[model samples]
Target: MNPKVSIIIPFYNCPYVDQAIESAINQTYPNIEIIVVDDGSTEFKEKLAPFQENIVYIRKENGGTATALNEGIRSATGEYIAWLSADDYFLPNKVAKQISFMMRENVEASFTNYNYMDETSQPIDHWTRPVFSNNDDVYRAFLNYNAINGCTVIIKKEVFEQAGYFNPNLRYTQDYEMWVRLLIEGYKIYYLDEELTKFRIHKESGTYKHQQAMQQEISIVENEYKPLLKEYIARNLE
Candidate 1:
């Protein structure tokens, strides 16, 4: 039996968020539940009015994306879970193709390649996300760098249940922490060679900005992954 997928979208007044929601609602796969978290958007309320009941809209006081995402995950009803940002969109086949791969491979988490687009939505560059085609590579890629962008991941609900939600303490780089924690735990990871998501790079983009949040992110990895990093390194030695 195919499990329903809960699609979580964390948003601010990002003009592009509406486009992201539109893309999710029109998925070729209808077994999806769309949950949008309005993380204290002062202007987007009116823009989002039309999407009210069609999409599960939750308004929370201004917090960070990590908190907003945690709220969405708690409200999700589907057996499978995935996340997207307001400024990004997914291909029509994004859910179908990736979910099919997860089921066939019996993996807990999966992601695909992505393209970077300009504000006008033109592709400027691409990051082929096949950095971790297998579980072993997933661990390796973590220490080297994070490759699986949160928007591109479709993970089983159990991953969140066992591994837990994004760290509330983190305002940024929560996705990197989440992804690394999963890989370190020996969870099965599969990287589809397909590009099923579009990531837009613009001024308000949180992760794209190299700021203090970045420094905090590195501190997070060093502190949280300390034990696991050592364990993975020991196991990898041939």
Candidate 2:
């Protein structure tokens, strides 16, 4: 049987949520369960009405993206979990290709390169992530720069059971923090060189709004994991 992949889209007040939902619905992969967690949006219900029949919609009081994602994960019933941002969308073969790669390599977590798009969904640039041969390299790369895009990642459900969920307190760099934890816990993350997802860049996007905060949080996460990374490298070198 094809493994079920749960695509969790956590959004606050994105007007382009329909595009995101449509992307999930259009995946060529058969066994997919799309869960949309609305983080206290006021007017999206009407917009979501058409796709309501196709997706599992959950509304909650105002919370951060991490909280909304945790809610979706709690309700998810899939062997694998994937994340799609409200402003971003996936290619039709995104899920299929990732699943095939994961199964063939026997890996629990994997991420792909992505195309940077404008608010109108027109491609502007391509983000080609670095390839890591092992989990240690993933950790070191993350410490230097975040190569894993949250919207491009497809992780096994058990990896969360081992590494835990996103930190609810972290308003910025939540996904980065989770990646560090997963790498530290010995989860090997495979990188697919294909650009199977579209990452939209807009003024209202979180990255633009919380630029400074993200940098500060990334520094904190790096410091917190530096000692652990050193020990792992030393042991492996010996």
Candidate 3:
């Protein structure tokens, strides 16, 4: 049997959440579960009603994406976890292809390339991330900025048990911090050069609305992890 994958979609009041749910439901991979975390959504609650039967819906008081994700993760039963932002959608073969790569490479965690879409779901930029030659380069790149897109990542459930969950206080940069923490715990995020996820950018999206705040949090995470990352590089990397 193919390994089961739990696709967790952290949802707020974003209108495009239905699309995210649909994408997960439509994945080509047969062995997968969709967990939709509703973070106190008020405006677009009706949008989720149609698909509530198709997903594991958990509604909690408004906390943040990190909290929503943690809730979903705790409830997940699959061997692997994949995060799909409420505004983002994955291609049909996203899980199947990424799982194939992870099994073949013997990696516990990995992130793939992703394209961009607008609020209307129209394609924008294609494959927006830089190509890294090796894990060393990937770690070094983290010193400057986050190269891994959280929505494109698929990680082993056991990895979280060892590295711990996302920091609840990090409202925006939790994914960035989590990625760095995994590295600190000696978990490598292998890169799969396939654009399997479509990240949506809209006026209401947190990335668009929280630019300054996100940068501040990113800087804090970078500073907190930089020393450790440098030591890891010196100790492990060539």
Each model's backbone clash number: 0, 0, 0
After superposition of all CA atoms, the RMSD between model 3 and the true structure is: 1.2
Model 1 misplaced stretches (Cα beyond 4 Å): 126-133, 236-238
- Ranking of models by lDDT: 3, 2, 1
Error of model 2, residue 93, in angstroms: 0.1
Using TM-score as the yardstick, the better of models 1 and 2 is 2
Better of 1 and 2 by lDDT: 2
Q: Rank the candidates by TM-score, best first.
A: 3, 2, 1
List, residue by residue over 1-238, the lDDT tens digit for candidate 3.
5999999998898888889999999999999999999898888888888997889989899999999999999999999999999889999999999999999999999998888888788888653567887778889888788889999999999888878999999999999999998887789999988889998878988988999999999888988998998898889885
**Candidate 2: residue pairs that collide:** none
What digit string (tens of lDDT, one per residue) describes model 1 on residues 58-87?
989988888998899889999888899999
TM-score of each: 0.92, 0.94, 0.97
User: Against the true structure, whose TM-score is highest?
Assistant: 3
In model 3, what lDDT does residue 226 have? 88
What is the TM-score (0 to 1) of candidate 2? 0.94
lDDT per residue (tens digit) for residues 210-229 in model 2: 99988898888888986786
